[model samples]
Target: MLVLPALFDEANKLRRLTVEVMQRLDAAGIDSALPDLPGCNESRQPLDAQSLDHWRACAMAAAAHFSATHVLTLRGGVLAAPPEMPGWNYAPVAGRQVLRSMLRARTIAAREAGREETIEALQQLGRREGVELAGWPLGAKLFAQLEDAAPQPDSAQVEIDQGTIGGGGLWLRAEPDEAPEQADTLAAAVAMGISTV
Candidate 1:
């Protein structure tokens, strides 16, 4: 089976750790591939125009690259079982929690920047992401735990349970009001998860 990663957060800040994990997995002869989605790293596109359907198409293409079955850890609750594909399972990882956190960070950044337009845009983004970022501190806190969430499990090869294993600290594209460094760091972290270098 191919171990696909979560879209946005998969390669965010934890690039090194991600590569290390993949290397170990490959050495053990375990099959896996981190398909690049539209608007993500190395995929030529902007996040502003991406849609759920676009992501599904990218995933389908990735699945086609491999003859065996594919497993995806998708956020935004966007992944659905493909009728044409055999042996596919929908692992609904903690999408709601992640979305909530993303909204919080984005909305806060917009508010700080004094940009009403940006704030509205982020609110819309939050809605599409399927989780409200308004006043969900508890959920936000859980998501914040990703701040220190390790890219690799302590054992270096934790198995996916239920729907998640070591995926939590995702730094989504920040609002225009936010700092680019934060977003860059996040993107790097996610890349580490998919990297074999």
Candidate 2:
């Protein structure tokens, strides 16, 4: 299985949950790989130079490199999941929704600091040059791509509902957290899904 994590701050919040799910998958005798996106984690690539197309290419490369037969995309990660692969998208989200949340956060921060920032203005700036949201330096191309990016419709990909996990998503939390039961349930769900495939 190739696991693609949620983007931005949600990625930070879901790291532990992702790991927990991977660990459970390992215990279930399923192998998994979580490759770092080009501009994320330990990668030396500059975030400002990356676009959605680049990320999608990198994801396809990772899938091929890992010889993965299945993929699991979390939240905004769904936007980059390889369309040809059989997989599950856990609580899929559109790229614009992800960016809007970050943009709103930035606006709030600006207001708190006695500066005014509107979403429209920020989006205009983002579309022109780029904008740093929640510390991620997004390029104009990437920002523009995200503005209209949605998950590709693929019959091979199954959507995993949050309700199936029996709780609010980990991404909804303000900080990183662990939910052992959620991990257990999610892993079991994936295991079952793979078994039937």
Candidate 3:
């Protein structure tokens, strides 16, 4: 299985959870890989230079490279799943919602700083010279690509929700931390879903 991570904070905050899930999967004899997408991780390619289509293509290539039979997506990572591969989604999110939240925060900050940054201007700037949105350098194509992108429709796969695992959303925590319980729960859910196949 190929483990596709969520964007930004959702991905960073769940780093420990990903590690925990991987350990559990290993114990269950379910092998998986968490490959870094192009322009992400240690890649020299600047984030703003990458288009969403490029990421999608990279995902498909990674799946092939790993010879993965299934994908395990977390949150907005659902957008990267290759259609040909079967997969499971956990807390899928729409990219548009995420972008909107980022833009809103940026707009609010600009207002307080007495800067005139409108959404349209930012969109235009992003398309022209790459703009930083919520700390991520977004290329115009990528920003436009995600504007209407929703989670890939359920494709005969499983979707797990760890909300009841307690302590609210781990991604929302002010400080970085781990949710061992949630990780275990997620691992079990993943294992169970894979077992059915």
Candidate 4:
């Protein structure tokens, strides 16, 4: 299994949960690997030079390199999942939805600073040069790509709802957190799913 984490700040918030899930999977004797996407984690690539297409390609390469037979995507990570791979998407989110949340945060911060900013204006700027949202610098190409990005439908993939995991999404929290129950439920679900496959 290849684990793809949530994007940007959500990734930070859900890191612990992802790790917990991986640990559980390992305990279940299910081998899994998490690859650092280009421009993310310890990768040396600059975020400003990465686009969604590039990330998708990198994900595919990672899956191949890991010899993964399955994938698990979380939140916005679903946008980059290899189309042909059998997998589970945990709380899938659209790219536009992710950008909107970030843009809203930027606008709120601008207001807090006694400066006016609008989502339209920020988007315009993002589509021109680039824009930084929640500390992530997004290139114009990447920003534009995100405007229409969504998970591609694949018959081989199964959608996993948050309710099925028995907890609120860690990504929705203001800070990083972990839920053992959620991790246990998710890992067990994946283990069972893989067994049937």
Candidate 5:
């Protein structure tokens, strides 16, 4: 097994690089099983609300499934694992994911707050909160790619009629099938080493 931060918590405590690593391992014909920590991802609980022992249980669950495991910790602390196959903290995917999560949460908040018209709030976010406290310039580049940040999917993509300060902008048209992606932010954040600017 390979260890990393839980990426897709909505699903489970996903070892993001595991599948990719497994593919490499499989090319060499190695096998592995990755499981989620309890109260996270697919386990169906609130990780932010879970206890350390609960997290330990999660790792133990992983242990029960896999005979061997290699845990690589992101952030400063390595997620506790059973004294199994070499566990250690490597680099930081936290910065990248954290930024993306914040940005997404902010976007969602703005969209929900604005409902039909969230662009104004977003632009302000680009102005005020965009830079963050660390003096990073998280300007238009991060969210500019989004079609629009409107809440409803059935809504129009953009509302460009007249008197729009930044010229005509794209309305956030709703697409029931589409959600959001971190690839852009991941690339952008990774380029900045998880920091925003």
Candidate 6:
């Protein structure tokens, strides 16, 4: 198993969830790997130096390195799924949506700081030099690519939604915390999905 986590803030907030899922998979006797992308996790690579395609390639390489027969994507990770593998997606979201949300946050901050910034201006800046949003220095090339990215149609063999079992989105919380119920529900769903796959 190869588990792909959500990008940026979502990744930070959902770390526990990923661990829970991994534990469940291990208990079910399915070995799993959560490889860090080049510009992510504990990597030394600068985020501004990486493009979306680079991340995809990194994911493919990790999958190969781990001998992953199937993938497990969460949130924006759906965008990086290896084309040749079958997998499950847990609450997948589009890249563009994620970018737009980040942009909105930047816009608000810019206004508060008395620095005017429009979406077009930010896009232009991203095109020239990487833009920093919510402390993450995202590459201009990657930002541009995200503007038009949609989730891959065949990325996952199973799609699981746990919205109904939810509290608010953990990512949006000021202090990140765990949702055991949500994790439990998601783990059970993933286990079932893997069994069928």
Reference-based TM-score, model 1: 0.50
RMSD of each candidate?
A: 11.4, 0.9, 2.0, 0.9, 16.9, 1.7
Compared with the true structure, what per-residue lDDT tens digits does model 1 show for residues 46-162?
554555445656666766777535343433222422434432222233444555455656667666889653544654444444223343322222233322232222322223332
Residue-level lDDT tens digits of model 2 in 46-157: 9899999999999999999999999999999888888889989999999899999999999999999999999999999999999999899999999999999998775478
TM-scores, in order shown?
Answer: 0.50, 0.98, 0.89, 0.97, 0.39, 0.91
lDDT-superior candidate, 2 or 3: 2
In terms of lDDT, the poorest run of 10 residues in model 4 is: 150-159
Better of 5 and 6 by lDDT: 6
lDDT per residue as tens, model 5, 15-68:
333344334444444454555555334666543344434455666666556654
Over 1-197, each residue of candidate 3 has an lDDT whose tens digit, in order, gives 89988776678877788888889999999899998766666678888778778888989899888888889888778777776578788787888877777787799888999987888788778667777877888877787777777775656456776563556667667676898888888888888878787
C-alpha lDDT of all candidate models, in order: 0.42, 0.92, 0.78, 0.92, 0.36, 0.81
- List residue ranges in candidate 6 displaced over 4 A: none
Model 2 misplaced stretches (Cα beyond 4 Å): none
Writing each residue's lDDT as its tens digit, candidate 6 over 130-171 gives 688777898878888877777777654467765744677666
Candidate 3 lDDT score at position 30: 89
Runs in model 4 lying further than 4 Å from the true structure: none
Considering lDDT, where higher is better, how would the candidates rank from best to worst? 2, 4, 6, 3, 1, 5
The alpha-carbon lDDT assigned to residue 50 of candidate 2 equals 90
lDDT of 4 by residue, 12-108 (tens): 9999889999999999998899988889888899999999999999899999999999999999999889878998999999999999999999999
